[model samples]
Target: MSSQPAIIVSSLDMDRIEALIEKMPRLTPEVEQLENELDRATIVAPEAIPANVVTMNSTVRFKFIGDDKVFEKTLVYPHDLKHDEQVSIFAPVGSALLGLAVGQSLNWPMPNSQSRTVEILEVLYQPERAGEYLR
Candidate 1:
């Protein structure tokens, strides 16, 4: 995988993610990846986030590079995940998707010591864009 592209995360989301990380029982590779992302993130006020950027609770459309199949999923915290369509922030793909803007791509690490390129095609809904900063 190449160097990661720039990412922007909302301050509120960053705070919540940090708290969640603090409660984890152990540091998994996924957790470490998330921490790396958090460390490099450009944080902005919730209202200042671009509408096309994926934020916590945002529903996004994305696809693996070179794949014709596109998928839509909602990025959610662990406790709020209730179905297959929702991805926890602790998940590798979910962590990779956080803060990515529409048209941006990242090389997502897999458990098998491989990586896949994932591109953000669209952000269908973002809580910050909807004025739901407290969510």
Candidate 2:
């Protein structure tokens, strides 16, 4: 029973993520969490997703609750993670960022058995927003 907020996902991103999950040799807890998120997500067409929503390859600015630090990341597939600014979707924080819209928040479960509240400050570069949906 997490207090995680509802999420929306693009159809194309969902399809790609599902295919990646099927290829995984083992399903870890983080991966399982991602599966759960996907299961509960409201799926929408890429063209239909709002420009403010986070999609694959979106550059997002967010911050943890109770922390004044703001972090930026570009959500990407595993293969595309070659830089510090890019976060792989397989990672826990990355999974938590998916589908969140500006001003929305998520409860990310930490490895220390605690949770951190992450709030989306803005979506600087959404694929759909820039007309780069094929990514």
Q: Top model by lDDT, which number? A: 1
- Evaluate model 2: give its TM-score: 0.95
**lDDT tens per residue, model 1, 7-120:** 999999999999998988898998998898889899999989999999999999999998899989999999999999999999888999999999999987878898888899
The digit string of per-residue lDDT tens for model 2 on 1-135 reads 456677899999999999999999999889999999899999999999998888899999999999999999999999999999999998888999999989999988767778888899999999898888897
TM-score of every model?
0.96, 0.95
Compared with the true structure, the alpha-carbon lDDT of candidate 2 equals 0.91
* Residue-level lDDT for 130 in candidate 1: 87
Report clash pairs, candidate 1: none
Colliding residue pairs in candidate 2: none
